[model samples]
Target: MGIKGLTKLIGDNAPRAINTNEIHSLFGRKIAIDASMCIYQLLVAVRVGADNLTNDEGEVTSHLNGLFYRTIRLLEIGIKPVYVFDGAPPTMKSGELTKRAEAKKAAEEAAKKAREEGDLEMAEKFSRRVNRVTPAMIDSCKRLVRAMGVPAVEAPCEAEAQCAELVKNGDLFATASEDMDSLTFGTSRLIRYLWAGTASTASKKGIKPTEFALDVVLQDLDLTLPQFIDLCILCGCDYVDGIKGVGVVKALNLIRKHGDLQKVVDTLKKEKSYTVPDPYPVEVLRQMFVEPIVTPAKDVVLKWKRPDVNAIKKLMIEENQFDSAKIENGIKRLLAAKQKTSQVRVDSFFKRATAPNEAERAAKRKAVAETNKKSKKSKTQKSSTSTKGRAAKAKKDVT
Candidate 1:
């Protein structure tokens, strides 16, 4: 869906460049998340043996469940998340959408065939790929997020583009999405594998989320941001076809030598097998990547408030038939975390208020040491004077 083979390209070419850390390491950070991506991931990952979360009316609720719990987990760990939703798709994305629909159809057929053959493993694998986020699912997710007091944004175009814009404007610390396209969208930092840590079982023990800083990636690739986008395009972007016989490594090398996309196109034109597009809208794609429509910074309001537990219970437990015990337990955890964070802030405030400044404390200690030294000197001098007088009186008695 992003630049095809882009993640692999970074792994192979610039190994040891991206940052990797535990999920909790993002504490106290404000992250702009691509909600659509998260929803798709949750829908795919939450299934158990072809069974997903559904309510009384047989409506799928996996997206809501994932969003609710995931947001709670983020809050418990002190992460402030702003969920950005996708609005209308850009005209260029129409082709990508069609391709995805066809792929999902093929996956569905493959899953059916696998099920008929009694190959459960293969069927499950195919089924995961076929899962899609629906409009109803989006609405449910938004409702859940609102009840939890997190910001939910409707982006003008791609959610990742808006996230990138927020990060660039300093409204967010980074963008969270699995798609490597966030990098091309000019996000200063991108987070991946956020859902990888949901399980603590032995099989999922080694999986952890990773962070990628754009500056480090660019430094490792020896290219500017624009050049990196061009490299991604050459590797293959969703908007256009790439030249035949050109791959990621080859693209990087060409970009390194040519310095720009136009130069790279001119060089590739001379090749016998490589055929550049006639009306290559590579420029247009670049423009979209660099600057996309997004909500202005002035309009964005991010404030964390107390979770509406009654509303959450009514929606998830009463209406949707989610386990009441689980919801209540989660609510308790949210309350506990809120109190704990508040207590921490109060403790920190008093500690700072009562604690003396290092410089003043040092000066007081120095003065006390000097006074002790002067008193000790006076005692020794008095003792010597008394001893001399006693000796003088004894000499006079001997005379």
Candidate 2:
């Protein structure tokens, strides 16, 4: 669903762009999480015999349970997560949406058949495909996220795009999601495997979370942002069908050669080896990726407040039948975490550890001065391409 095969392709091709990061290393970081994506994963993961975890009222609580625990864990570790919920989907995604709906329906039928045949495993597998994030589920999650003192944004369109906008606007440090499409949306940093499972479980399973840097990717691939978008399209995105028979490597080669989607399409027409979709909607898809619809930066407000324990209790305990003692313990832990983080910020911690002493600084300055006295620096001396500058470019208007 997410620019199919793009994650593996990037890992294989752009090593500089990706790095394994310790969770504690991200202390005091603000990350924007794709709520819908997380909820879908949670629904799949926390299941009870092909059905979701539900309360006495027969309403699903898996999403809430997973989100509550995950968000708390992230916060306790000093990583402030901003949950971004998807609003309306893009019109360009109609084809993909329709296909998904059809697939879900088929899975439901198959699951029914399998259950009748007493193939529980097969039924469970197919039943997962039937899971969809409903509006009510999203609303409940947003409420829960807010109750936990996390900021929540209802993205105007795709949550990935909105998260990207936040990163560019300096509202967040990264986009946390399993989807590679976050790169296509222009998030400066994309975090993977953070929400794949519980931290202990992930550690035991050897699942290390990684952060992807887009600037390094662009620099390494020797492609402009537009060209990179074209490359992703070629690799197959939800918006448009990619050229038949063209793979990730071939797509990269084509984009590097032809320069853009239109040019690539033109070349494909001449070469019968690859089949392009009839009436290929290149311009529309390009527009969707290039200038995705997002809430205006001025209108967006992200504020992380103190966790309202009473509100959380009301939602999780009084309403959803979550154990009162467990909820109370979670609140205490969240408060303790907040207190600890408040006393020691990540920046201060890093500065204390890494900053040079007076003697060392003086020696470094003397060495630099002597080197500069004898050196003729080139104007073209390459500086490292970085994802860090995206923050300093933040406008004065937005809070």
Q: Give per-residue CA lDDT, model 2, range 43-118, as digits (tens).
A: 9988788899998899999999888887878877778788898889887788999999999999999999999999
What's the TM-score of each model vs. the native? Answer: 0.81, 0.84
Candidate number achieving the greatest TM-score relative to the actual structure: 2
RMSD of each: 18.0, 14.5
Candidate 1 to truth, TM: 0.81
Predicted structure 2: lDDT: 0.83
lDDT of 1: 0.80
lDDT of 2 at 99: 94
Candidate 2 Cα misplacement greater than 4 A, ranges = 197-200, 341-399
Cα lDDT of model 1 by residue, 301-364, tens digit: 8776788888889889988998999999988887766643332222323421222334555576
Error of 2 at 213 (Å): 0.6
Q: Model 2, residue 397: displacement in angstroms?
A: 85
Weakest 10 consecutive residues of candidate 2 by summed lDDT: 378-387
On the 0 to 100 scale, the lDDT of residue 234 in model 2 is 83
